[model samples]
Target: MIDVLIVDDDKLVRKGLMSAMPWDSFGMRVIGEAANGEKALEFLKENHVDLLMTDVAMPVMSGIELIRIVRKRYPDMAIAVLTLHQDFEYIQEALRLGAVDYIAKVQLEKERFEEVLGRIHGLILNQRRKPPNEPASVDQDVYPLDTAYAVLGLGDHPLVNGPRQHSQGWRVEADGHILLWTPDLREELWTEVNSDREWLPPLPDQALDADWRLVRLRHIAGLTQFDLLQMVRNYRQRDFFYDCNGYETNPIEKSVQELQADQPEPSEREIEAVKEILHAFRWVHDSQSFEELCSQLRKLRLPASKLMQLLYGFIVDWSRLFKALAKTGITLPDTFLCWSEVVAWMGGFREVAATLSGHLQLSREVTVSIMSAVKIAHDELEFPLFAVDVAKRVNLSRSYFNQCFKAIVGYSFNEYLRRVRIDKAREYLAQTAKPIVWIAEHTGYADEKYFSRIFREQTGLLPSEYRNRHRQR
Candidate 1:
């Protein structure tokens, strides 16, 4: 039988999950539950959990960190994340760290949650592929969601965060389920039944976070396994790209349509600008902070062209990220898609900052710490948070965190952060299919011309051309 743990600070979430059903009948059993990630990690060291269902945001230790540690030690561990809609960034980070899926706690009731769990349990049970290189875990029960499910919420969650993990119903019958919905459910929870008027259990008095709930949505149907998986992937991608360096705030669907209204590029231009920008930015460039160049552009010395003439020497940043991912042969996904896709699949400014800070540096721990914070900031879409602040969140120190990060990631805090923002702009130009002006604002570069110049330098292709070239399938 599969060994699993249910983690959530809210007592109701925990209680509802616990009483949902006994896993032994479904080829699994509940091993334990923890209130927080720190506690969960401690439990993990002494015990083994084949699967994990956890909340993303929690005090002491966020679910993101817990997954990070778990993925490192147990890559095959099946993971599901739970968080509020506002916490998409956290979900994105967790996705990148390898949580297979997420659920909006307010959405589905315990019954639906258990159904999804059954499907996930099915996927885990069905998986037979083993990493060719790594030693196989003796636990045959450990399984990850299929890639399709990873991006979808488990499978067709109407919302980015919902109970979409399960495709069909559960196998065994419950003796009796006392359906409970959290009293404070602000809005109707995602695609599930809430009609059961069963009184729900309350959260533990010591629960963390504000506004806990026990909820069940009513009348959920027409959801199949395939449809659900697609939904999860779509949401996963959206969350990943939501705060990426190049995230356009709008979808390429617009640009795809606009391509009809606007004329194609002049024959002479030929997207050479894109080529030039990429060529220029092979190294030295980071975060669109070229002052002398910006000064001249501000003075009207250069033409206001769509070409990314400013971006230069940014390949180093890309190189760093590329190298890191190559270690796993996993390509990071693009940011700026709609919600519900693979978390790592999204990439952008926030991603660049985190990647450059940690990967550009030679140091491992400092890089890891910075990566942790950047990831948190990216998940939250808030940046420039203090080093100390990031350190504290990741349970590190100002000095040791700095040292460890520098030692592993290979860039000092400031220098690496600069690279992150700039590279994010470059990526935006190439990936998001957004306008140059908008890309500048999102990547922390207010000046469009300067942003363009930096783009040209780093990518050797002007913003538009680079985008065109990469945009072509």
Candidate 2:
């Protein structure tokens, strides 16, 4: 059997890997577990292990250092990393250091255990059958093409005039933009070109003001002319998705299969929790609560698709609530490619939320009317309560009642009622193992499929999947 050693800082994670996985089924055995890279090295010195599955971040020696050492000491042993979505940079580094593959820590759910282990098993087997001197099946230096080149962009500045040639690279002007192709793959080369003030011409009385943009694929030796041009076009198209200051390392290039594989369906409960926190932020303006929201978001480790969905929901809801207060356009990109982009976008959103919250001014009468209407919707979930009926009950005209409800609740009366029923259905699904049809009927959804469709739209999960996720939690 293939012997495996698992290393992570968390005792719970180590224990989970040791006990929860069916190692024998994959023709592997968990021979040992370690809390950190240092401990892992110590264990390796005394034990025989064929596979090392390690986490990238730890207290003592990091996984990167451990991999570097282990690669030299035991070149034949297979290495894999346990990584979160945000650890892509570290993952790239590990892969470059000869890691065969990586397993997402979030994919350790019981249902996905076999699929993950099987993939790892296959990779290790492939490595064992390959000749040591042979290069990897696919060339890392050039990706999706044969030739290697690099793309560089220099902004309008006094130091750079039009397209200029360097000894290391060729430069040309395209569409009023400078495009440079270089075969140099060294980090220092890109760093100096992008940021080294010494490489730039000194101004007489001011600091250098220039924007240097570099685009390179990870593990690529260089980019081809076609690849460079394609990447440059992609960079321009996705300008809004990236931060303005930093050079783009990996452009937004992903296959549909890769995106679908990366996106994990978020539960209704998860979405609701975020909404609750955001709603609280809108009214109370509590810094602690907002910080907690950020903390929770980080902890969730949501993939870009799910994160974008959650943020889109928030923006749409907020836009409805603050329609009159909205002085500027609020929008979201079609998708986000990385966690850092999401964080940057969220920072801007925090400002928008604060600005809109400050502009909110609700009178006692409006507040009471809205609250009463909300209470009625909650109390009469099974009944078909129309907005007009609730409006009359709250002693307001239909139009006035709709305006107040949307302003206060961040959803239209119909939308709010639908959400209330779905939320009620979610409670039933989580708290008890009730039949889905029964739950649907009680939540005012006569058809189970209709209820599931609505639930999926709101939560990104089906009723059953949402229930299963809650149980796993």
Candidate 3:
């Protein structure tokens, strides 16, 4: 049975909630009750609970504060909020602090209450089975690759970008690229076809798929247990854990298998440094003062490359928090790809700081402005929708608008427009049997060749190849 705790300031309310539900039916039992966050903390110090359901308002400490404290202290524990109609704001804040669900205080009937309890129970069980840091393991005995050969050197691509149906095989990563094992004989066939690096897989109406830039290894015959282990080590440094795009249905199990001791824990001074940088980022959004923020960043006295890495790590940390807060998919721009290029393109750490601050302020008016602009641009993607056009609608200058948009949305106006169009093209390719020319035009491209070029640049696949691969999936 799952242990539970109830926290509310009102004594009668706490008692009523404790007795209101048949928690045992849902494999839960209220092990304790507290009248406020203070009492709850005291209880938690002496006891343990799988779940904590608390009221938003309380004396000594508010529920929001308690949730923050618990999130930092006991991250694995599930949390829920007790909220009245006017307390929804608190519930939102609670959820931002990692609350799993919220309960309407007035609707604590047995049926509704049991349903919510059951869900929390299931969530706890599911999370126990799959921690975020642990990779899913695969059985090599059942899926042997001894008779097959592998193709290596395919650069970063989506892990699940494979045919829907095929004989048993696995895609692995090595040397900062991907490898695929399958029954194969001709090593020269792929080399000759992709000699110019032009042809790709999943071509429209093609019965046979081509190897998409994956170089077949002639010397290495088949995959062994040692090969898989080495693949894990190769992937450990490829930032695969930070890249959120390739998690679903990924065959590579050890995507985040970094050596902990090698990755030295941030020293006490380093933690304080990051906190100072975060404070500066927060101050920028609050005061709209870029100079003061830059002054803070400059005070760190780190070189440009180290500064970029620090900023990148800061963004990664916040991205994780943003994902938790929004309970939605939030992928940062792959700007961490080349630090020198990103620093040069961003002009300095100041712009990078500003951009990250904007991303952190998702609930602010600045976010609303950018989102409105996105809606308008997406509505008129086929037309020549320019940044100036969006700025005009949002009542801001193009230059300032681009700055805020990049900060808040993590991409410039043109880059976002292209990405949105490409995303639409992906949808069309996957869902419809339209011709490549039709898809290109339908997604705002007048020339199919231009569209294909942009598509390859964005997705590493031609229109036909993407369509075929996604369609099969």
Candidate 4:
């Protein structure tokens, strides 16, 4: 796979790029990301990456400077720049400095971003086929791959900040993981590494040769720090993949007949498991419970495609369930459009479980009480309702209620009430011969003038004008 690194100061952009793209389908993956060029450079020092996608402007070190340095040190690596509309000059300079292409930040929609990434993937693959142009002398290199072995620290592990070496290889403690590298290149040595519980490798592509499982074997001839870092990044990413019996099963190679033939009707116990997870989600607020739910999900033995389908079905079911609970004119968030977007962001079933759990856990208080309070407000519009009255009905202090309401409903309590009142007013204006005053009073407005003012502010028309324009006749 073509491993990529994203460098940007904007977290939103980082997340968007991370979640929005079809990475695996394009034969690429985001091995790591950095907020600025300095961090990006540091990541590069530890990982072997095929491509670098960076923003034009950043805090620590600018992308142009990074590009110039990368071009000098890693001449074979492909580079891309993310530029703003006003950064045309910078883009030109980046291209001159050795960047392969540029993407306008403002226009980074899903289609365009994938298109650019796919192009870069093709370029990288092509470049890999060609031989490296670097001189074949160890003396020219700062840390030549042939002599001194590179050591990488695992993240937050007990062995971190320490170094050890056997006659066979060198090992360094990372934060929590231990990275080992050696020039031995023996098949048995790698097999032993693979057998270790602490080692997590990429999902094996069974379609390829079995020897392919040891990724280091293919790259050891010209191994750089990037290669070592890339291996660690690849290992970490396996956590995001859906595991079946503790291994990755490639779904793309399976035939349609095999997929359809293996599908079995879900058992009652499996159905109940789904229900129990959803039930727990409504009350689960802490990360511990959320993670527990994710852990339980890994035990499921369904195929990856089937598992994804089941998760999407659950999201749809939950959306309808949530809407029904609200019992009012509440519109669900726009996130309902594609469940695959959620799955794509997560890469596998466990991640899907965690994300769904987190989403369901939002604003537990708002969901339980405001749902009932919404029904009260909608059904009791003619009785005069206020934010405090709704809060009182829900047994919440007005300030806390307003906060939860806004957090869960995307609108303040007052805003929701006004919206409801105006919507009902419009319906009556279109369907009945009632006077504007009667309509206002029925929809909870005490004064006809005040209703007219708010109605115009919301719908851009006076009540009579709206009726004349939209009434059946």
Candidate 5:
């Protein structure tokens, strides 16, 4: 049976999960339970666990922290995050940290338990069967080509009946279009009709069903199956950006190498222009300035990849500048697949920028006071600090200060204090050979054991273990 450990801060949640799930029938057993990440780590240290089911938010150590530590310490163990709909950002982090799957808490009762268990079990088995040292192959059938072939798009043609099987050559379907890669052009697939371009053939509408029509049929040579799919995607993205009528008959004669070489880095002038736009946008909230910025971006002739890189840099800057002011739940996609996606993201960010600009315009004084309080908190981490004391230092009532603090910082004063203290403790443990007791005392914990408990709760590892782990790294 697969030995599982369930970790959650809620006693009721842990007990309910343990009792409600039919573990025996699924060939799994919940051999252990933990109140939080720290307790989970303690249980893991003493027992052999095959799978760990954990919640995202908890009292001391967060599910993200637990997943990070567990992934490193127990690379063989499978992890599945227990998440709510609101915990999307945390869930993303968990998945990036090697979580194989997620169980939605809200859907647990609504969905079939057997199906969930079966899916988890299948994923765990697949993960175990993978070799540790090599990257997982995207497709087992992917093989290097001795001679690259031309890839053609056959748009929803009934000539090809099934998926991944075509008599002409290797076939792959993407976005309702069938892509075929062959050594030579098959004339039988198309009918000669009126065409402005000599190389292009006009598709016969009578041959297709009423539901289907011929889209663009162009060919690019020197591509493998993987490269063919990628080229098709690039073509689609190009079509979207250019607003092309699918009838463009021009063949893509440029090789993949040529395409790669065409994507140049943003020049120094472009970089400086972006910086100027960002500065102006942040400090000056004129609608005309926003329009000008968008116009300038649209006028650029940079490839989608380079444009995305520039935009991603802008996103990073915005993230750093408005981190405290922005809601903690907001998440931006790390990569954009096409120009349309980038445009959509920019539109969303425009709304966010307007909201943040309003905050800056109306709450300049509050922002300054909160920032001062944060600076004081950072500077005075060694001593006992309380919200009431910080509020007094910042010249505000305790309750009012808390309201502004949470509004601007996305965390309560006490929670932020604990996080900073533990963060400092972590730095000391990792960078220095200092005694655990001294580190604890210096980080505002009077008792070493109590400090260790809190540290474990935040990090899922004791001070010594954390230090040792970092040292090994």
Candidate 6:
């Protein structure tokens, strides 16, 4: 039987709740109770209850604080917040602290209470199957990925834009609706679509009778369930909201075969570096003052760009860690993603650390990405590093690197280099009217016609138009 604990300060309320739910029918056994957060902590110290349902406002410690402490220490405990509707502050805090359900007293009839209990039971069962310290051998129980459908317009979205990192969701066309899908949001949609029973299966290959149907998507990223959970949670705002534009169905599964196919998966060096970075925030006392910790990063032998990638990766991981906390009845502020904007927000590390957070934003993980453009730009318009060689150095497939480089830097390597060379040639042209052939050679363009074509495409005017426009401006 699943063990349980109900914590509240009121004696009558505690007894009433114990008698209200038929614990046996829901596969639960009430094991204990606590009148305050201190008492709850004591109970947790002694017992291994599968779940802990508690009142938010209590003596000695608030329910949110209790949840926070539990999330930090006993991350395994599931939590539910029992508070009045008037406790709006507590409700938000409770959700951040990992409260699985928030039920008001006035609406707590036996029928509704039973339903809440069942969902709590389902959620708890899900939590028991996950633990942070375990290794790969213990990872097979990852949550099953579900199919989800969503509709996002090309406008501001809370779920996508997040405070720090912008979302890279793709817009796909189906039924004439422009759809945007982020793997993170897709995971939430998948869980919701699976948990909600309103769905009725459609006839196979009948073009989907309804506006939506359940989809089974594969978690082809090759992340374990925990990693997948972290990926979604990291991108989401604690108080994040999204628009319901339209919907489409998606099915997902764990990408075990894809991972195996990676032929020597992720390197141990990369994995070790990421691990160190995640644990870094713990060492730094504050994130608000990052310059104070710049030396610390240098000590880790991490460059600034590499450190940034690690920070981004950890932001995603911390978000996932919060999910486990939510399952255990601990919720963090939805403003959690604000940690990512630290560098831009704070002028330097010293200023931020003096305030608090002491550069604790992402706990400082090491992820290195080469900043070749910035390096190559100053030397000449045509970089000595060929496009293929640059791609090989970054350890990306030729095609994949081409796509990633363009996405991150906003231009293809050769394309951008050509543009720069052409622009330089334009300078020489307007300044002294150099020969087109000389300009082409300087820009690394084998064909003068090709150089002119690319220059016109980029500037929306031919090389001549560009020279004339610059003179006019």
RMSD to native for every prediction?
25.9, 15.1, 24.0, 18.1, 19.3, 24.6
Whose lDDT is higher: candidate 3's or candidate 6's? Answer: 3
Query: What are the Cα lDDT values of the candidates?
Result: 0.48, 0.64, 0.57, 0.57, 0.63, 0.50
- Highest TM-score model number: 2
In model 2, pairs of residues that clash are: 148-223, 149-222, 149-223, 149-224
Model 4 segments more than 4 A misplaced = 129-473
Best by lDDT: 2
- Candidate 5 least-lDDT 10 residues: 188-197
> Which stretch of 10 consecutive residues in model 3 shows the poorest summed lDDT?
252-261
- Model 5 TM-score is 0.32
Across 1-473, the per-residue lDDT of candidate 6 in tens digits comes to 88888888998888999988878878898989889989988988889987888888788998888889988897667777787652333365566456655656644665456555755775565556656665632222333444323332221212221121123333222111122233343344556646664543232222223232222223423333333222222112110111111233332122333222211223557556545644443323334424444333333433223444655665554333222212323222222122233333323322332232222222222111223332344245543557777666645556765665564345677765665676677777688677777777776676889878887877677777777777887
TM-score of 3: 0.29
Q: Is candidate 1 or candidate 6 better by TM-score?
A: 6
* Candidate 1 vs candidate 6, lDDT winner: 6
Q: Can you write out model 5's per-residue Cα lDDT over 1-473, one digit (the tens) per residue?
A: 89999999888889988998888976899999999999999999999999999998888999989999998999899998887642333355676577766776755752347645765776676666678887743322333322223333322223333334344454434222434443223334332311223443333232234222123333333333444444444443333333322344444343444333333334678867866775433323345656677666665544444565676676565454446744534456755534446556666766664576366453544555676677666668889999999998877889989987887677889988888899899999988899998999899999999999999999999999999999899
Give the 10-residue window scoring lowest on summed lDDT in candidate 4: 204-213
Number of colliding residue pairs in each model: 105, 4, 2, 20, 1, 48
Question: Candidate 6: where is the Cα deviation over 4 Å?
Answer: 86-89, 131-473
The candidate with the higher lDDT, 1 or 5, is: 5
RMSD of 2: 15.1
Q: Which ten-residue region of model 6 has the weakest summed lDDT?
A: 236-245
lDDT of 3 by residue, 129-149 (tens): 766887632312222211223
Measured with C-alpha atoms, the lDDT of residue 266 in candidate 2 is: 55
